[model samples]
Target chain A: MAKQKEEKLHKIRKVTPGSVINYTLITLIALICLYPFLNVVAYSFSGYNAVLSNKVTFFPIDFTVSAYKEILGKASIWLSMRTTIIVTLVGTALSLTLTTVAAYVLSRPNLPGKRIMSTFMLFTMYVTGGMIPTFLVVKGVGLYDSLASLFLPVAVSVYNFIVMRTFIMGLPFDLEEAAKIDGASEMQILIKIIIPLSLPIIATIGLFYAVNYWNDYFNALIYIITPEKFTLQLRLRNLLFAGELNSAGANAEGIGTQVMTQSLKMATVVVSTVPILLVYPWLQKYFVKGVMAGSVKG
Target chain B: MKQTDDKNKAALRRTTWKQIRKCKWLYIMMIPVLAYFVVFRYAPIGGIVIAFKNYNVFKGIWASPWCGFATFQKIFANKNFWNAVRNTLTLNLLNLAVSFPITIIISLMLNEVLHLRFKKVTQSILYLPHFISWVVVAGIATNLFTQQGGTINNILNAMGHDSVPFLSDNGWWIFTYIICNVWKEVGWGTIIYLAALTGVDETLYEAAYLDGATKFQRLIYITLPSIKPVIVTMLILSISSMMSIGLDAPLLLGNSKVQDVSNVISTYTYQLGIQQAQYSESTAIGLFQSAINIIILLAADRIAKAMGEHGII
Candidate 1:
């Protein structure tokens, strides 16, 4: 008991004045970041009348789940959610394959015309043809209003490709040379050796692509005209915009609509954000490390 | 040695031919990326010709008759376009002047914190707002600042002051836009600086401490110099993107009263192209914006290289 008390006192003593100040500043900043999100949650949960009266701030004064119930009860929200999921999954898969394959090829020192190909790819980063021509091209290609429009147009990010290439370049060449000496084909070596070692970068880039695709509503807005093909973001945008038109004092039906709309908007934000946020903690260490590594080398 | 040289030449030619034969698979792999650029990026260059032509949907791109810069004439003739240009440049300049320094300062402070747990939590919290779309953020802002039942209004009413029309006021439009943008993006902007700060040598800080330097002095003399390359790189990048003052925030935040102050090149182009289908005029304006962006980027790159900083050459 005496030893335990002493150890606890030692731990307390280790907390210097600088550390105390640091912790306080960090806590304050964290609170500032967290407060607005909490306010949103509070407002979403608080009764409509309570929220209108500005009674809700950090916490709900009169709690209710009617907003959520109304939002979740709708079939359209579910459908949009389903579409967003499909787009995210499919888009990530396509992007990862294209980026990895291209990066692998470019990373090979023996690859012919590597420098020219790389330069050609990098040129696109700065000199895009602008929006009108792109829209016309999409029209020309018959991809307008199609789901492929979202995935295909942005199939590979040049930045991701560069990062992945840099990473693959940093890998020891001895392994590849060894595989070649053993008469292993290029495909076999890539499948067996290179892939296992490259998992961290692959995962990091995959998550980045996934998050980008999930957050993207721009493509859907520009390309998709049909209401049925709307992603969650576009759907949420429509709902939020719809709220603006009906912002006056709620009618009998309007109250339900407003509550439901507000709740669903918050819920949609949470839904779109949560999966990426959840994955972040798992992948964050690699992400930070990989990004720093990639940036510094580049 | 002569025989080996001849053999090597033969091998080189043989390998070149083999590569050509295998080019089909490589080309197939490149199709998606190439198609994307061709469709989205390269195709847009052709649309710039619409600026010269009196664009007609029926006549299509090729058949549209030349109007000899009538669209450019109209664009420059508009007083509203000049207002937009002025607004865009001023707002961007202000954003750079304020937010850039603040981002660096915040990053340095965050980096200086010794407690890992505290740093992680702060970073995570700070980054949260970045992920929430601007539309949602605008909604939140409106709710907070609304005259009737908003939190700000409630506080003002309690303090015996009349509520201000934050959203509707033309004077407040730029300020509102800047604040909302800063709120949403300050954390994200700090990322590169933080990454740069991590590279700062700990020994320098220790040396400053031994010389009896205070934290502020250490930051000024040691920390700032360590991250100078990163600062320059980011500054140049930001300068390059000056014309792309995003459309979403202003579109959501600006009401009819504030529209004159809030309208920018991008929003103007969207209006002209997508709304009015005045493709020629819009493409002209877009091309103009692109030209300016390219010039700025080249100039910035040149300046960086002149200063012995690495650039995206």
Candidate 2:
């Protein structure tokens, strides 16, 4: 009994220094990751004068929602927001459907040309024809300048396909065999039996697809030429790169100009990121799961 | 004997057709996918022929006059092209050297955490940055790194130090680029390593503990050796695509002040092909990048296989 207590005490002592160092480092990194976003939030909510005086830090200085108000009132922001919503919704649905169908088909053991089909998809992951050729193909297909251009050309990600396929392949063969014995067709089996069991993966992959579409600016930048058709990221990029975020009728005096512009830019950042941030916590657990699933095949 | 071989070939082909016919539903399901691959992927592959031609909108791809290495010659002659190549290589190498090991180290540290709640919370927060768009990352970076009354600069001035031109100076801009890249990705990169670490046997650790191995010794002996395969795989995968850098980071983080340091292959191709209408030269540059990528990928896969690691390919 004395020896047991002594060993326990020794184990506890050994853990202290390592745990302290690990916690300290992890906490510091977490703070570093969270600080920039917090800074943006603080700047966006700070009073114009406080921001102008460069006093905003971890907390908002002289808090106000006027920056968000001014931003929300803008027609261009609303237009871009609407465009982004449409693209994300449509893009996610299309990508999920195509990816699921492809993955399911490819996952079948007795499916003809399964190896060749898998290789066909996998080959693209390594050697893409670079940017311009893909651009030309998108143009040739009449998707240019449309919302379809944002998602259609890149609908079925090979990585996502592989991940989803791996998930499906792990399901017991007897489940499908039983369904097949009952005269359920492949489509019916997929919709009724396979999908019901695979909701976790579907939800996870759906979130992946949604995030990809939501955050994509490269597609919108390269394809969408019109200002009004810009997605949220593209619009945010324009606002940022243009460097003119001054409110139309607000105070245009002295240092207030830079402060207002900077605050407004920060507010735009807040606005653009809010959608992803809102859905983030709910989908976060699934993201870790998805990463694991993907990495197994990877 | 020749006739028998021919008969066997015909019989094999018939069986193949019969199997394909039996799996007609699967083939039907694959229609959209195959079309997507053909049009979006393989078609672009065929579009590489334009690199050899002076691509003209009116003449189209086939009607355009083939230039016979002229585009490659032009790209080689251009100083900006060389500069872009150098910058891409330097930035990628820097990223590989710094961010790669940091990812493994962070994962190891996280794995060592005694409290589950602390581990989960840190992971949640760390993964947050990866989901944020590059535009937002750039915007936030600008807010922090700008010389005039920027957050970092303001803090520096308050501490009696001169302001740093993080966005304006070429070298500092590269530093800022790396910081942003590492900051955005480091946590997310840990996920793969963490996943690999989970596969490590718990029994080994218990045995080590029983053998009077210190925590650090166990980590050095058992933990490090176990995760080495994953590390090697990830390293090879990264090394295989050394020439390819995503356009978003460089383009969004860059300004005219640091163009020399920031212009990577993707951004350079974008500017040349889209903005300047130098399509043939851009295509040629892209083709060159693709060729180098394939060579590296094959060589890396071969080396990995030769080293008795499972082939990544």
Candidate 3:
């Protein structure tokens, strides 16, 4: 048995010249992928002179927190941050609730009118009213120019609903059937049996929703009119493209212009992205599972 | 027998109605979702009718006068609309050409690695960029590709070469756009392919090894064929959606200097409808794009089925 095991291990670990090349190529590609992010972090922490001199690369030459301090000290940044937090939290909750309920009900294969209901949801995936008409609807519904417009207009993602429903439908039906025999109601069955068994998919769908809400700026850009209601991504776009770093700082005329350099811009980028980056490693395994499940589509 | 068939049909209809009535709680749960679809999805579709009318702000959507394809006529004549269509197709084709094969090749390479640890780390790093917003990506890109104190430019200057206008010159701007896009999405694209690759039976490779097949030969004979369905499916899906580009990437990566090349359908709709208040014209363009999209989708599905692959439709 030991000799057979050794032979199998040898077969698996055969040193191929091609594999050596593959490893080297993959490592280089991975470094290439990671360097841009590292460069952003390096520039954000590097001193102004180091940044101006183009000395910062993948590491900080002369580190300082002044850029972060200058950006984070402002009232507008906090206000926008607050607004973004509110939207992401409320949007994710609303989306998950709507999606969960819809998915659970739709997952039952024996449900009447299931075909029509699913077709109603799936048709939206292919064709939509386009942006302008959707904009008109938002306005017509009186959701225009409000924080609600940012998320309420897109409350239940058809893709997310399909994924969650697929997950639910794939579960063992015997448990639910037994519970039904024991006089458990559908709601009770869902809350007691389905939810506990569906933690992985629920977590995956929740993360997808949170990431969508967190990263979205277009909804905010179109529907949100007020300066105070700008989400983090919208505010970042304004600063990055329009160079609104002046409005983000308390004392603008002197220091804002002086500090409104590339370093400061990159610093703001890093700060806005930190929340997702912090949670990513923990959420990544679920993300891969979610993608794998969703990829098996009709 | 015919009379029994009629009786069965009647009984089935009654049972279906009874089942629906019995599942009152389920339907009650579905009300909010149905309402959401009605207000947002179905209503927007109905709102597409504004394309055939002169939409008035005060008169609202219903009171707007019917114009009977005049809005579409105006859109069809506009040079900007043609330019947008041209740019949209150009960028999408370029993206498909560059990123599609690269994703497959990367997935193949990752599959070949014996070192599981190395492969896992590489994949984790590669997938990171897909999660980052386009705003951050554009910001990082501006820092790296700008002609002034850009890092790449600094390297070029140090090598005694002139700095390139990555984001300014039209040709270079397209190159930059594709690079950023591929960098961001190429890794994430491999997930599906890798998943497909895993479904390939290991016995095929083992038998090929007994036949003294080289690694490359095994890949060609045993691996590629296994995932061909997935490849074909993805290709059809990508081709069908060729008319649409997301607003975020082009809008964020683009500046006024390259508006001639950057203006696509979504951005054009935004600029015209929201910024200039040409709601009718913009919606007309949108409806036109949607018509082409549906046609392409149906054609692609037909092609897929003809090729003996499952149609996405």
Candidate 4:
């Protein structure tokens, strides 16, 4: 295996025609994926005229920070940003707690009624309560139009629960038995030993929850009614599509006028997306592991 | 004999109770999770019955009168509902047709890329799109595909050609939609295949090379066959989900003009249920869609098993 791996490494320099084609195709696909983000940055930072005249492509023309300033200056944008941050933070915390506890309880192979409880959770994955009825329930429970409606209804994802459970299951089972023999309770084992050891899986699942909460516009669109409570994704949607300008400092010249700066529009995307991009390189491997574990067994 | 049987039953009950008592804390931990599933997951299922009722918002579900199959009938009679159903299938199939093979080809290409570092970087870039919100993707698409100021269109204009209406026209909208979908997920789709790729026997490749098999020939014979099961499983999985398209993509990417092609089942339900407040009818449509989905899923799983593979489900 080591010999083969080393040979594979050496083959990089011995580039055949097929390898050349492979490299070119891979690079092209990468560029296609990446160029849009570059364009987003270019449009977000370019001068107003440059954006208007379509001068920006992959690089900023007459680069300026006014679009970012304009967007950041607005009360609506900041409010939405605050709402998104709260959702991501609170949602991730709740999801991690719920998923961790459930995973621990389910990972106990000797636990009575494990099959029933696990099948109950797993069934939710195959068939869901479809959209409208779920909406009615949320509304019926008095979560309608409230900020709690954003995250509380989706407190735990079954897939993430399973992934976390799978991770916990893969740990040496004897450790828990040893703890039990030492007079440690199940809760004590989970709190004192399991959590500390399961930090990687915790972070992976936590990031999953965070990204879901941050990019969640559909939930906000359906559940949230108040303008001030709109999440960042929903707020960006309105700014991009509704042609509704701000009522504040961002548009001091013409308040409530439909004067949209394309640059500012693109800036919202950048602002919304930059966090994901920043952490993506780090997130890629963990995400890959989570998917592999969750999927292969499934 | 009767007394002994009763005593045995009593002993079983006591052991069961003891086991429960031992893991009592685990049971305590399960309360919130159990309540969440009961309230959020199963309640909505029970709520799906309102599709058969004359659902009144003020009257509530319990008070709503039964209308037999009237709500389902109303949805079935609507032309737009049929249109939405057709559009959903078209877009999903089109999306699968374009994306599935491209994903496999790219995975194969990625596998052949000799430079490990370059391959990793490429994969990283590809996976980036799967993380971004559809709102941002829609925003980026608009900025890049619009006729007037869209960068791609602008480039065309600069070359003295009329700009293409990528988003507005129906035919082009589907094409653009497929392109966007492929761009977003094609990279992430490779993860499973690449994992499968690593398990392929290296000796087969070495043997093929010793026999003077060309690179393309080796790829076709050795590389492709190795990952066929993953490919089939993934294909069946996608096919099973044909009835369901995410609400975000179509609802965001679509405009007034392209609604004919873009108005999918999920979006249609949203329009009727949430926007128009025709709650009962919307629920009926959802129920109908899910019924079809289950049938398709079962059929696909059977097909998988019939082909001498483990069922997808």
Candidate 5:
């Protein structure tokens, strides 16, 4: 087995010109992908006056930590950040649990009412009842203006469920058979065998759910009335639309309109994005692989 | 034999009950999801009746008196409604025309590169813009295209040229919106195409190479045909979402100066429903948008089937 593994490694090391070109292109594309993010980071740290003067570009010209300090000093920013973190964590947990069970049940090849249920799920994807109806539904359920409103309404993503079902379906049946032969129940088989092997896809889906919850402003914009319940994205939108930089201790009069707003906008963008961006690199390989895997089956 | 048959039937029933009992954990697991969709998806669907009712706050949806087709009639009579429809269709079509081909080309270019690390880097860079929210992108765009001391104006002034109001101009609004959207989304869009490209048989590419087919020719014959199914599937998907041009971009970028061109069904509905509290009329318009989207999706799916492609049915 060791010799065979070594031989496989040796074969993989046989590089071709095509492979070299592929590496180069991917690297260049990755840099291009990272550039705008880098530009935002640069602009966010650059002095407000310097950034407004258009002195900052790919790199910060007059780097200052004041913008960071200014934003951090705000009590509301921290509150919103805490709210977003709570929402994202709770939402992802709920989404994952429900999505997994529902997907697993739906994925059972001979499960009763499988076709009917699948069609029902698919119907929701294609034909939603629209915003007002959905809002009414939320209100009807007594989830209005609550944290439960944020997580409960968006618990099952049909797309993620589909991806998960596809992944679960692709798992080897031999393992389940072995568990059954050992007198283990179907539930035990899933818990002990299927879940352990399904971690990559589960994690990938969880990340996707987390990002969705984190980036979600529309729900907060519509459902949330209290300022205390605001997510990061909603707060950013409020800042941009309301132009309330004067309240943040920035001398709005001294700073040019474009520079202050743009820089502060950049700051908001950075703050809202950094947490997700930080988590992405760790899961990116799984994410890309999961996406490809999911697409292939579909 | 009769006794054995009776025993088997009893066992089957017992097993079914046993299975249900055994999977109680799974049922528990599904509760949150079930509750969520019930409240959000199923419940909101019930709210569709508001379109046909007066929908007074005190009376609420159930208690409100039905006013059949009045909201629809009002929506039809409103000039802004028609303008929004026209703008949405035009912008979506333009986005389809421009962004679709560019995504394919970029994917092809990325595929052609032999160096894995370089290709990965490029992909990462390209995908970065997708992560930035539309609100920030709109901010960047306005900064670049603003009339005074903006980047575009500064560049134009250097050439002794006049700077045009790109954002506010009706003719330019659609173009600007499309460009910014493509810039943000195109890289992410390439992901599906790239996955499809991987499925192309290696032998076909080798055969083409042996036949002295150039890279470009190989791409035309081997690569394009390989990913055609994905393209068709995505096109169908895009057509499904054609009416939903997303409220965020158009709302953020739009102002009173350029409302005519930038307004879409979603933003208009939000304006009526949320901002103005014209609940019944907005719901009617919302229903109209949903109907249009469904029609287009069904039509597109039919076209895909006619073209011998598997479509989302």
Candidate 6:
């Protein structure tokens, strides 16, 4: 009993001087990752004079929401937000459906041509036809200038498919076999037995697709010309790079002039990132699992 | 002999058909995905022919007049193309140099933490930036790094130092770029290493502890060796795609003054193909890049296998 207690005490580890330094460095690194964001929030909420004077750092000085009020009051921001939400929802649905069906179909043990199909899919991962060719094809197929151009052309990520396949293939063989023996078709088996158990992976992959669609500015930048149809990221890019924020601020309820462009820009950024921040904590654990599964590389 | 071969072919065909028939529903389900691959992935491969032709919007891929190596010749001679290639190499190398070692080290640090709550909170904060869009990141970056009334520069000025120009200056721009990338991806990169670290046997550490080994010694003796395969694999993967870089960071972070330093192949291709409408030349550049990528990947795979490491291929 004494020996076991000693072993347990030893297992708990001693708080050495080295460990104190280690914890300090680790905490410092985490703080470095966080401070820039804290600065942004500080800027977004700070009064115009405080931000212009460069006093906002860790927290809002002279806290005010005029920037947010000016930004939220704008129609352009709302339109782009709606556009992005639609694209995210529709794109996630399409990508999830296609990827789930593909992963399920390809995961079957005795499925004919499974190897060939998998090799076909994997081949695309190594060799892509380059951006110009992809653009040509997307435009040639009449998907240009449409919101579908953002997602349909790149709906099924092979990485997500492989990860989903690994998850499905890891399912208990007996459960699936028992279902098959009970006269369930492959479709029925997938719907009744597989999907219910595979919901975690499905949610992980769906979040991946949704995040991809949300962050996809390049596609919208290349494909869509109409400002009305612009995704939020695209609109945000325009607001940043278009250098129109000067005029944009001038017309925004007259507080635009009172609000610094820096605050306005940061406020827009904070709003656009809120959805991701909201969803991330809830789904953070799943992301680790998703990435680990992906790193297995099928 | 011919009759026997024919009979064997028929039998093989019949069995293949029987197997396929048994899984017809699976095949039916695969039709859309197969169609997607054919149209989006494979069909563009056929479009690579435009690299050798004078690509015209009205002429189309099939009707474009063949120009042989002329477009490739033009791309090869362009100083801008060479500059872009050099810039891409510089940025990618610098990025990997900072991110690679830091990722491994941070993984070790996280592994050493005894408090689960503290580790979890730190990790979640670190990973939060990965989910933020580049547009948002750039916005945040500008607010922090800009010279005129920017937060960092303002702090420097307050400290009685010269304010650094992070955006307009090429050297400083590259520094800013690396900082942004490292800040955003360092936490996420720890995931793969942490996963590898978890797979290391616990008893080795316990045994080492009983032998009076320090934590540092345990990490060096046991943890490092255990995660060496993953480390080797990551190095091979990163080295293989050294020629390719993303378009977002360079394009968004770049401006007119720093174009000399920031115009990588991807952004160059975007400019030439979409902005300038020099389709054939841009397509040739893409082909050249893809060719370089394949060659590098294959060579890396060969070197890895020859060195007795598990090759990424």
TM-score, each model? 0.89, 0.94, 0.95, 0.94, 0.88, 0.95
Mind giving the per-residue lDDT tens digits that candidate 1 earns over B20-100?
565545556666666666666667765678789988889888898999877899999999888878778878888888889
lDDT of 6 by residue, B149-250 (tens): 778888899999998989878999999999999998999899999999888998788788879897779988999999988998998888877889989898
Greater lDDT among 1 and 5 belongs to 5
Candidates' DockQ values? 0.34, 0.49, 0.53, 0.49, 0.33, 0.51
lDDT (tens digit, per residue) of candidate 5 on A1-298? 6765564455357676765766665566566556556667777777767765765556776777777777888999999999989999999988887888878877775454567667767678867778777776777778788877887878889999989988998999887878879998667777898889889999889988998888788888888999999988888877765542113332212235333445666677788888877887777778777787679654
Which of the two, 4 or 6, has more TM-score?
6
Residue-by-residue lDDT tens digits, candidate 6, A100-214: 9999999988677999999999889888888889999999899999999999899899999999998888889999888888889989998999899888888889888989899
Clashing pairs in 1: A129-B41, A133-B44
Write one digit per residue (lDDT tens) for candidate 5, span B241-300: 878878888877776556778778888888778777787888788788888888988899
Clashes of each: 2, 0, 0, 0, 47, 0
Interface RMSD of each: 4.9, 4.9, 4.8, 5.2, 5.5, 4.6
The parts of candidate 4 lying over 4 Å away from their true place are A1-13, A243-258, B1-10
| Model 6: residue A75 alpha-carbon error in angstroms | 1.1
What value does the lDDT take at residue A80 in candidate 1? 85
State the TM-score of candidate 5 restricted to chain B.
Answer: 0.94
Count of backbone collisions within predicted model 6: 0
Alpha carbon lDDT of residue A274, candidate 5? 81
The numbered model that scores best in DockQ is: 3
Deviation of model 5 at A92, angstroms: 0.9
Task: Give the distance in Å from residue A84's predicted Cα in candidate 4 to where it truly belongs.
Answer: 0.5
Q: How accurate locally is residue B1 in candidate 5, as Cα lDDT from 0 to 100?
A: 100
Give lDDT per model, in order: 0.75, 0.87, 0.87, 0.86, 0.77, 0.87
Ranking by DockQ: 3, 6, 2, 4, 1, 5
